[model samples]
Target: MDLLEEYRRATMFFESGDPGGAARLLEPIVAAEPENASVRQLLARAYFASAQLVRAEEQLRALLEIDPSDHYAHHVLGRTLERQGRPEEALGSLRIAAAMRPDNDDYRAALRRVEARTGGRPR
Candidate 1:
Protein backbone atom coordinates (compact mmCIF):
# COMPACT_ATOMS: atom_id res chain seq x y z
CA MET A 1 0.00 0.00 0.00
CA ASP A 2 1.12 3.51 -0.72
CA LEU A 3 1.43 4.84 2.82
CA LEU A 4 1.89 8.46 1.82
CA GLU A 5 -1.20 8.45 -0.37
CA GLU A 6 -3.08 6.62 2.37
CA TYR A 7 -1.96 9.19 4.87
CA ARG A 8 -3.21 11.95 2.59
CA ARG A 9 -6.50 10.13 2.23
CA ALA A 10 -6.74 9.84 5.99
CA THR A 11 -6.00 13.51 6.35
CA MET A 12 -8.72 14.36 3.89
CA PHE A 13 -11.12 12.09 5.72
CA PHE A 14 -10.30 13.81 9.01
CA GLU A 15 -10.68 17.25 7.45
CA SER A 16 -14.04 16.23 6.02
CA GLY A 17 -15.30 15.39 9.53
CA ASP A 18 -15.15 11.59 9.25
CA PRO A 19 -12.82 10.86 12.08
CA GLY A 20 -13.69 7.19 12.33
CA GLY A 21 -12.88 6.73 8.67
CA ALA A 22 -9.66 8.62 9.14
CA ALA A 23 -8.80 6.39 12.08
CA ARG A 24 -9.47 3.22 10.09
CA LEU A 25 -7.18 4.41 7.35
CA LEU A 26 -4.51 5.56 9.79
CA GLU A 27 -4.36 2.36 11.87
CA PRO A 28 -2.36 0.48 9.27
CA ILE A 29 -0.06 3.42 8.59
CA VAL A 30 0.65 3.70 12.30
CA ALA A 31 1.33 -0.03 12.57
CA ALA A 32 3.80 0.22 9.70
CA GLU A 33 5.46 3.35 11.08
CA PRO A 34 5.24 3.07 14.82
CA GLU A 35 7.82 5.79 15.35
CA ASN A 36 6.17 8.33 13.06
CA ALA A 37 5.06 10.99 15.45
CA SER A 38 2.93 12.84 12.93
CA VAL A 39 1.00 9.73 11.95
CA ARG A 40 0.57 8.67 15.56
CA GLN A 41 -0.62 12.12 16.58
CA LEU A 42 -3.20 12.23 13.80
CA LEU A 43 -4.41 8.73 14.66
CA ALA A 44 -4.69 9.75 18.30
CA ARG A 45 -6.70 12.78 17.31
CA ALA A 46 -8.98 10.72 15.10
CA TYR A 47 -9.65 8.37 17.98
CA PHE A 48 -10.34 11.29 20.29
CA ALA A 49 -12.69 12.93 17.81
CA SER A 50 -14.52 9.65 17.38
CA ALA A 51 -15.11 9.27 21.14
CA GLN A 52 -12.78 6.31 21.40
CA LEU A 53 -11.21 7.64 24.56
CA VAL A 54 -9.40 4.45 25.59
CA ARG A 55 -7.74 4.08 22.21
CA ALA A 56 -6.98 7.77 22.12
CA GLU A 57 -5.36 7.57 25.54
CA GLU A 58 -3.28 4.62 24.48
CA GLN A 59 -2.07 6.33 21.33
CA LEU A 60 -1.47 9.62 23.13
CA ARG A 61 0.51 7.87 25.85
CA ALA A 62 2.59 6.10 23.24
CA LEU A 63 3.20 9.42 21.56
CA LEU A 64 4.45 10.78 24.87
CA GLU A 65 6.77 7.80 25.32
CA ILE A 66 8.21 8.68 21.92
CA ASP A 67 8.45 12.35 22.86
CA PRO A 68 7.57 13.33 26.39
CA SER A 69 8.00 16.99 25.50
CA ASP A 70 4.91 16.81 23.27
CA HIS A 71 2.58 19.24 24.97
CA TYR A 72 -0.32 18.40 22.67
CA ALA A 73 -0.05 14.73 23.53
CA HIS A 74 -0.09 15.61 27.21
CA HIS A 75 -3.07 17.86 26.69
CA VAL A 76 -5.01 15.23 24.76
CA LEU A 77 -4.18 12.54 27.26
CA GLY A 78 -5.63 14.83 29.90
CA ARG A 79 -8.69 15.34 27.74
CA THR A 80 -9.12 11.61 27.21
CA LEU A 81 -8.98 11.03 30.95
CA GLU A 82 -11.40 13.86 31.53
CA ARG A 83 -13.80 12.41 28.97
CA GLN A 84 -13.56 9.10 30.81
CA GLY A 85 -14.67 10.87 34.00
CA ARG A 86 -11.25 10.53 35.59
CA PRO A 87 -10.60 14.16 36.36
CA GLU A 88 -8.08 13.39 39.08
CA GLU A 89 -6.03 11.28 36.69
CA ALA A 90 -6.29 14.06 34.12
CA LEU A 91 -4.68 16.69 36.32
CA GLY A 92 -1.06 15.61 35.93
CA SER A 93 -1.07 15.64 32.15
CA LEU A 94 -3.02 18.89 32.01
CA ARG A 95 -0.55 20.49 34.34
CA ILE A 96 2.38 19.32 32.24
CA ALA A 97 0.83 20.60 29.01
CA ALA A 98 0.01 23.93 30.58
CA ALA A 99 3.54 24.28 31.93
CA MET A 100 5.14 23.21 28.68
CA ARG A 101 3.18 25.72 26.64
CA PRO A 102 2.34 28.54 28.95
CA ASP A 103 1.37 30.71 26.02
CA ASN A 104 -1.31 28.28 24.84
CA ASP A 105 -4.69 29.55 25.91
CA ASP A 106 -6.42 26.24 25.14
CA TYR A 107 -4.01 24.23 27.24
CA ARG A 108 -4.24 26.66 30.14
CA ALA A 109 -8.01 26.66 29.86
CA ALA A 110 -8.12 22.87 30.01
CA LEU A 111 -5.90 22.94 33.09
CA ARG A 112 -8.06 25.53 34.82
CA ARG A 113 -11.26 23.64 34.05
CA VAL A 114 -9.88 20.38 35.37
CA GLU A 115 -8.41 22.05 38.42
CA ALA A 116 -11.80 23.58 39.13
CA ARG A 117 -13.49 20.23 38.67
CA THR A 118 -11.14 18.36 41.01
CA GLY A 119 -10.69 21.18 43.49
CA GLY A 120 -6.95 21.06 42.87
CA ARG A 121 -4.83 24.13 43.38
CA PRO A 122 -3.31 25.61 40.25
CA ARG A 123 0.22 24.50 39.57
Candidate 2:
Protein backbone atom coordinates (compact mmCIF):
# COMPACT_ATOMS: atom_id res chain seq x y z
CA MET A 1 0.00 0.00 0.00
CA ASP A 2 1.20 3.46 -0.83
CA LEU A 3 1.09 5.10 2.60
CA LEU A 4 1.55 8.55 1.13
CA GLU A 5 -1.32 8.04 -1.28
CA GLU A 6 -3.46 6.73 1.55
CA TYR A 7 -2.55 9.72 3.67
CA ARG A 8 -3.56 12.07 0.88
CA ARG A 9 -6.84 10.25 0.45
CA ALA A 10 -7.47 10.42 4.16
CA THR A 11 -6.74 14.14 4.10
CA MET A 12 -9.21 14.58 1.28
CA PHE A 13 -11.85 12.72 3.25
CA PHE A 14 -11.16 14.84 6.29
CA GLU A 15 -11.32 18.13 4.34
CA SER A 16 -14.50 16.99 2.62
CA GLY A 17 -16.25 16.62 5.98
CA ASP A 18 -16.10 12.84 6.09
CA PRO A 19 -14.10 12.54 9.27
CA GLY A 20 -15.21 9.03 10.09
CA GLY A 21 -14.02 7.93 6.69
CA ALA A 22 -10.76 9.70 7.24
CA ALA A 23 -10.33 8.05 10.60
CA ARG A 24 -10.97 4.65 9.09
CA LEU A 25 -8.48 5.26 6.34
CA LEU A 26 -5.89 6.70 8.70
CA GLU A 27 -6.05 3.88 11.24
CA PRO A 28 -3.85 1.53 9.22
CA ILE A 29 -1.44 4.27 8.23
CA VAL A 30 -0.99 5.18 11.85
CA ALA A 31 -0.42 1.54 12.73
CA ALA A 32 2.12 1.18 9.96
CA GLU A 33 3.98 4.31 11.02
CA PRO A 34 3.41 4.75 14.71
CA GLU A 35 6.15 7.36 15.01
CA ASN A 36 4.95 9.56 12.19
CA ALA A 37 3.74 12.73 13.90
CA SER A 38 2.07 14.11 10.78
CA VAL A 39 0.04 10.96 10.21
CA ARG A 40 -0.84 10.69 13.88
CA GLN A 41 -1.90 14.33 14.08
CA LEU A 42 -4.22 13.97 11.12
CA LEU A 43 -5.63 10.78 12.61
CA ALA A 44 -6.21 12.55 15.88
CA ARG A 45 -8.01 15.38 14.12
CA ALA A 46 -10.15 12.90 12.26
CA TYR A 47 -11.04 11.16 15.50
CA PHE A 48 -11.93 14.46 17.13
CA ALA A 49 -14.09 15.55 14.20
CA SER A 50 -15.83 12.17 14.31
CA ALA A 51 -16.61 12.67 18.02
CA GLN A 52 -14.29 9.83 19.00
CA LEU A 53 -12.96 11.96 21.80
CA VAL A 54 -11.23 9.19 23.72
CA ARG A 55 -9.23 8.11 20.69
CA ALA A 56 -8.49 11.72 19.88
CA GLU A 57 -7.22 12.32 23.39
CA GLU A 58 -5.02 9.27 23.21
CA GLN A 59 -3.44 10.35 19.94
CA LEU A 60 -3.01 13.93 21.14
CA ARG A 61 -1.32 12.76 24.29
CA ALA A 62 1.05 10.61 22.26
CA LEU A 63 1.82 13.65 20.14
CA LEU A 64 2.56 15.58 23.30
CA GLU A 65 4.92 12.87 24.40
CA ILE A 66 6.66 13.16 21.07
CA ASP A 67 6.82 16.97 21.20
CA PRO A 68 5.78 18.82 24.30
CA SER A 69 6.13 22.11 22.45
CA ASP A 70 3.27 21.27 20.12
CA HIS A 71 0.79 24.02 20.87
CA TYR A 72 -1.74 22.73 18.38
CA ALA A 73 -1.75 19.31 20.02
CA HIS A 74 -2.30 20.92 23.40
CA HIS A 75 -5.17 22.97 22.01
CA VAL A 76 -6.81 19.98 20.39
CA LEU A 77 -6.40 17.91 23.55
CA GLY A 78 -8.07 20.66 25.55
CA ARG A 79 -10.94 20.78 23.12
CA THR A 80 -11.30 17.01 23.24
CA LEU A 81 -11.45 17.06 27.02
CA GLU A 82 -14.03 19.85 26.92
CA ARG A 83 -16.18 17.91 24.47
CA GLN A 84 -16.01 14.94 26.82
CA GLY A 85 -17.58 17.13 29.52
CA ARG A 86 -14.35 17.42 31.46
CA PRO A 87 -13.94 21.17 31.47
CA GLU A 88 -11.83 21.11 34.59
CA GLU A 89 -9.54 18.51 33.14
CA ALA A 90 -9.27 20.59 30.00
CA LEU A 91 -7.88 23.64 31.81
CA GLY A 92 -4.22 22.64 31.99
CA SER A 93 -3.93 21.83 28.30
CA LEU A 94 -5.89 24.92 27.28
CA ARG A 95 -3.73 27.08 29.48
CA ILE A 96 -0.55 25.59 28.01
CA ALA A 97 -1.80 26.15 24.47
CA ALA A 98 -2.80 29.73 25.20
CA ALA A 99 0.49 30.44 26.92
CA MET A 100 2.49 28.92 24.10
CA ARG A 101 0.58 30.87 21.46
CA PRO A 102 -0.74 33.92 23.20
CA ASP A 103 -1.71 35.41 19.87
CA ASN A 104 -4.22 32.66 19.13
CA ASP A 105 -7.69 33.92 19.92
CA ASP A 106 -9.18 30.45 19.76
CA TYR A 107 -6.73 29.05 22.30
CA ARG A 108 -7.18 31.98 24.65
CA ALA A 109 -10.94 31.90 24.22
CA ALA A 110 -11.07 28.20 25.01
CA LEU A 111 -8.93 28.64 28.09
CA ARG A 112 -11.06 31.52 29.33
CA ARG A 113 -14.30 29.71 28.69
CA VAL A 114 -13.16 26.60 30.53
CA GLU A 115 -11.77 28.66 33.38
CA ALA A 116 -15.11 30.36 33.75
CA ARG A 117 -17.07 27.14 33.53
CA THR A 118 -14.89 25.42 36.11
CA GLY A 119 -14.63 28.51 38.30
CA GLY A 120 -10.88 28.38 37.77
CA ARG A 121 -10.75 25.13 39.67
CA PRO A 122 -11.02 21.48 38.99
CA ARG A 123 -14.32 19.82 39.70
Candidate 3:
Protein backbone atom coordinates (compact mmCIF):
# COMPACT_ATOMS: atom_id res chain seq x y z
CA MET A 1 0.00 0.00 0.00
CA ASP A 2 0.97 3.59 -0.48
CA LEU A 3 2.31 5.79 2.30
CA LEU A 4 -0.86 7.83 2.18
CA GLU A 5 -2.94 4.73 2.77
CA GLU A 6 -0.85 3.78 5.76
CA TYR A 7 -1.04 7.29 7.07
CA ARG A 8 -4.79 7.27 6.66
CA ARG A 9 -5.07 4.02 8.54
CA ALA A 10 -3.01 5.43 11.35
CA THR A 11 -5.10 8.56 11.43
CA MET A 12 -8.26 6.51 11.54
CA PHE A 13 -6.95 4.56 14.45
CA PHE A 14 -5.97 7.73 16.21
CA GLU A 15 -9.35 9.31 15.63
CA SER A 16 -11.01 6.19 16.93
CA GLY A 17 -9.21 6.63 20.23
CA ASP A 18 -6.74 3.84 19.55
CA PRO A 19 -3.50 5.75 19.74
CA GLY A 20 -1.42 2.72 20.62
CA GLY A 21 -2.53 1.05 17.46
CA ALA A 22 -1.89 4.23 15.52
CA ALA A 23 1.58 4.51 16.94
CA ARG A 24 2.32 0.91 16.12
CA LEU A 25 1.21 1.49 12.58
CA LEU A 26 3.13 4.70 12.16
CA GLU A 27 6.38 3.89 13.93
CA PRO A 28 8.02 2.14 11.02
CA ILE A 29 6.75 4.74 8.58
CA VAL A 30 8.25 7.42 10.79
CA ALA A 31 11.58 5.60 10.93
CA ALA A 32 11.65 5.06 7.18
CA GLU A 33 10.69 8.62 6.40
CA PRO A 34 12.60 10.47 9.04
CA GLU A 35 12.46 13.64 7.00
CA ASN A 36 8.73 13.41 6.29
CA ALA A 37 7.44 16.24 8.41
CA SER A 38 3.80 15.21 8.05
CA VAL A 39 4.49 11.65 9.19
CA ARG A 40 6.57 12.95 12.06
CA GLN A 41 3.80 15.31 13.04
CA LEU A 42 1.20 12.54 12.90
CA LEU A 43 3.39 10.22 14.90
CA ALA A 44 3.82 12.93 17.47
CA ARG A 45 0.06 13.32 17.65
CA ALA A 46 -0.35 9.62 18.19
CA TYR A 47 2.30 9.69 20.90
CA PHE A 48 0.53 12.53 22.62
CA ALA A 49 -2.79 10.76 22.44
CA SER A 50 -1.16 7.70 23.92
CA ALA A 51 0.13 9.83 26.83
CA GLN A 52 3.72 9.45 25.75
CA LEU A 53 4.44 13.10 26.38
CA VAL A 54 8.21 12.90 26.22
CA ARG A 55 8.18 11.07 22.91
CA ALA A 56 5.67 13.52 21.52
CA GLU A 57 7.85 16.42 22.57
CA GLU A 58 10.90 14.81 21.03
CA GLN A 59 9.15 14.24 17.69
CA LEU A 60 7.78 17.74 17.56
CA ARG A 61 11.19 19.19 18.39
CA ALA A 62 12.70 17.20 15.57
CA LEU A 63 10.00 18.39 13.21
CA LEU A 64 10.67 22.01 14.15
CA GLU A 65 14.39 21.52 13.58
CA ILE A 66 13.63 20.21 10.12
CA ASP A 67 11.17 22.99 9.27
CA PRO A 68 11.02 25.97 11.54
CA SER A 69 8.00 27.24 9.68
CA ASP A 70 5.94 24.12 10.37
CA HIS A 71 3.09 25.66 12.32
CA TYR A 72 1.67 22.27 13.29
CA ALA A 73 4.96 21.30 14.92
CA HIS A 74 4.98 24.56 16.87
CA HIS A 75 1.41 24.01 17.95
CA VAL A 76 2.03 20.42 19.05
CA LEU A 77 5.19 21.41 20.84
CA GLY A 78 3.25 24.06 22.71
CA ARG A 79 0.65 21.48 23.70
CA THR A 80 3.30 19.05 24.91
CA LEU A 81 5.00 21.79 26.90
CA GLU A 82 1.72 22.86 28.44
CA ARG A 83 1.03 19.28 29.48
CA GLN A 84 4.46 19.23 31.07
CA GLY A 85 3.52 22.22 33.25
CA ARG A 86 5.78 24.59 31.36
CA PRO A 87 3.33 27.30 30.34
CA GLU A 88 6.06 29.75 29.49
CA GLU A 89 7.61 27.39 27.01
CA ALA A 90 4.17 26.53 25.71
CA LEU A 91 3.47 30.19 25.06
CA GLY A 92 6.67 30.60 23.13
CA SER A 93 5.90 27.64 20.90
CA LEU A 94 2.21 28.46 20.50
CA ARG A 95 3.06 32.02 19.53
CA ILE A 96 5.18 30.76 16.66
CA ALA A 97 2.27 28.66 15.42
CA ALA A 98 -0.14 31.52 15.81
CA ALA A 99 2.16 33.90 13.96
CA MET A 100 2.55 31.39 11.15
CA ARG A 101 -1.19 31.05 10.75
CA PRO A 102 -2.82 34.14 12.12
CA ASP A 103 -6.20 33.11 10.83
CA ASN A 104 -6.40 29.88 12.82
CA ASP A 105 -8.60 30.34 15.85
CA ASP A 106 -7.33 27.18 17.55
CA TYR A 107 -3.77 28.41 17.37
CA ARG A 108 -4.77 31.88 18.53
CA ALA A 109 -6.80 30.47 21.42
CA ALA A 110 -4.01 28.18 22.52
CA LEU A 111 -1.55 31.06 22.41
CA ARG A 112 -3.90 33.23 24.49
CA ARG A 113 -4.43 30.50 27.07
CA VAL A 114 -0.70 29.88 27.41
CA GLU A 115 -0.03 33.59 27.70
CA ALA A 116 -2.62 33.94 30.43
CA ARG A 117 -1.18 31.03 32.37
CA THR A 118 2.36 32.39 32.08
CA GLY A 119 1.37 35.98 32.90
CA GLY A 120 3.01 37.29 29.75
CA ARG A 121 2.32 37.96 26.11
CA PRO A 122 2.46 35.02 23.75
CA ARG A 123 6.15 34.77 23.10
Q: Summarize candidate 3's per-residue lDDT along 1-105 as a digit string, tens digits.
A: 477789899999989999989998888898888999888888999999888999999999999899988898899899998998888878888888999999999
For all the candidates, what are their Cα RMSDs to the real structure? 1.7, 0.8, 2.1
User: How high is the CA lDDT of each candidate model?
Assistant: 0.96, 0.96, 0.88
Per-candidate clashes come to: 0, 0, 0
Give the Å error, residue 37, model 2. Answer: 0.7
Q: Candidate 1's residue-wise lDDT over 58-104, tens digit each?
A: 99999999999999999999999999999999999999999999999
User: Which pairs of residues collide in model 3?
Assistant: none
Better of 1 and 3 by lDDT: 1
Among all windows of ten consecutive residues in candidate 2, which has the lowest summed lDDT? Answer: 114-123
| Candidate with the greatest TM-score versus the true structure | 2
Deviation in Å, model 2, residue 80 alpha carbon: 0.4
Q: Where does model 2 exceed 4 Å of error?
A: none
Q: State the lDDT at 24 in candidate 3.
A: 88
